[model samples]
Target: MWKFTLRRILIMIPQIILLSILIFILAKMMPGDALTGMIDPNVSPERLEELREKLGWNDPWHIQYADWVGGLVQGDFGQSFRFKMPVTELIGERIVNSFWLSVATLIFTYLIAIPLGILSGRYNDSLLDQTITGYTYLGFATPLFIFALVMLWVFGFMLGWFPTSGSVSPGSEPGTFAYVMSKINHLILPAIAMALIATVNTVQYLRSEIIDTKQKDFILTARAKGASESRVYNRHILRNSLLPIAAFFGYEITFLIGGTIFVETIYNYPGMGLLFFESITLRDYSVVTAVVLLFGVAAILGALLSDIILSLVDPRIRIK
Candidate 1:
């Protein structure tokens, strides 16, 4: 297990480098310089040139990449051109808020998906299975933003059961029970929105896994041994069936990251998703690069997490 984990960690090094280079190239391809949004519109050409020189914008891309990587190693993510603050400080709190939303979404996703999957898979061809299938199709057809707005409108505008915007309510002192409750209350709607968007594939994956695992020779053998159906499924089938779902979480991570941009924007929630949208609009390249890099790193780590989980569930993975 240690060897496998170490190898995977080692593999990430080159992936990160390549990902960085790709982002840099893409950033370079944008029409204007980062300085475009940093100054007054009427600034003189000479002033813009001077500012460009000061920021080493004229430097070779390789040199700039080196500087950026060096800064990353030293914990300096550069300054936000628009905000004029350290990138880390600008995004630190927002990342936490995003983390809360992402975690909540994933939790709810599994909570809803796993049970439905088990039920539909366990009782295949029944009314419940048909209902779950219909729900998945409906969920797959609805756009995430549409679902979010419906949730916002029905729950936020008409019903008045949940707050539609923001991660916390005003005048709730941080760290208090009221503040915590406010956060959760504000969280429920958006989290559910993203979770429903996230749950579709998980449900399908686990359902298929359960169905396939049920027919495996081992499951048949267990049943042949006169084990009760419950024992056969509980002790053997479920354990083997969940392995694929564990691996599927990698896709979930990327999905949630992408979904958050839409969800956060709709909810007006303060998080990296909204930040990414705002930064792109403002052409705040420093924040953009940071957020994109964070997202890429998340994807890479998510793959690693899947491997780790696979190792945990299937001892053969660790033994090899």
Candidate 2:
């Protein structure tokens, strides 16, 4: 397992390099001068030219790329013109909120999705199974923004059960139970909206796994030994069915992080998603690149964690 993990991490080096290059290309494709993103808007041409000279803007493309990568290695993301602050500092603050929201969203996603999947699969074509199937399709079909809007309207305004936007109420007191509840309350609506959308894949995937595993020879052997239905389910069928779900978690995690951006935007929540959207609209290239890099890193880490989890749960996977 250790060897496999080390190999995977080693493999990630080239992927991260490729990701950085892709980000650089995308940033370069944006309209306007890169120098504009690094300077104050009201600066005179003289100052701009001075900065251009100082930063070696006249250097060859490869030299410039090397400089940028070197700066990145040293944790020196350029200043955000819009925020008037270091891009890393801005991302550092926002990423925490995104992390917590993602945690809440995944908690809701798996807790709700797993049970529905098992029930639907166990019951096969019964009414309960059909109902879950229909709902999963609805989730897959409904646009995220539309669903978020309706959730805001119905749950936020009509029922007044959740705060419509933001990470917490304006006056929320830190280090208090009320503050904690406020945070959780703010997360609930958006988390559920994202969860419902996220759960479709898990539910369908797990459901299919359960059904397929149920017909296997191993499952039959377990039953023939007079293993109780509950015992066979817990030990044989469900355990086997779960391996695929565990393996698929990396893809699900990447989707959740990416999808959270729109949900955060709609809710006006302070997170990487919202920050990424705002930075792009404001054309804050430094902040945009930082957020994109963090996102890529998050995706890579999520995949690595998924593999680790799969290996822990099934030794055969690690051995292979």
lDDT by candidate, in order shown: 0.88, 0.86
Give the per-residue lDDT digits (tens) of candidate 1, residues 127-216.
999999889989999999999999999999999999989999999999999999999998899999999877888887788888889889
Candidate no. 2 TM-score: 0.90
TM-score of each: 0.93, 0.90
By summed lDDT, the worst window of 10 consecutive residues in model 1 runs over: 32-41
Candidate 2 C-alpha error for residue 318, in Å: 5.8
Q: Report the Cα lDDT for candidate 2.
A: 0.86
Superposing all C-alpha atoms, what RMSD in Å does each candidate have to the true structure? Answer: 2.0, 2.6
lDDT of 1 at 14: 98
Clashes of each: 0, 0
For residue 154, model 1's alpha carbon misses the true position, in angstroms, by 1.8
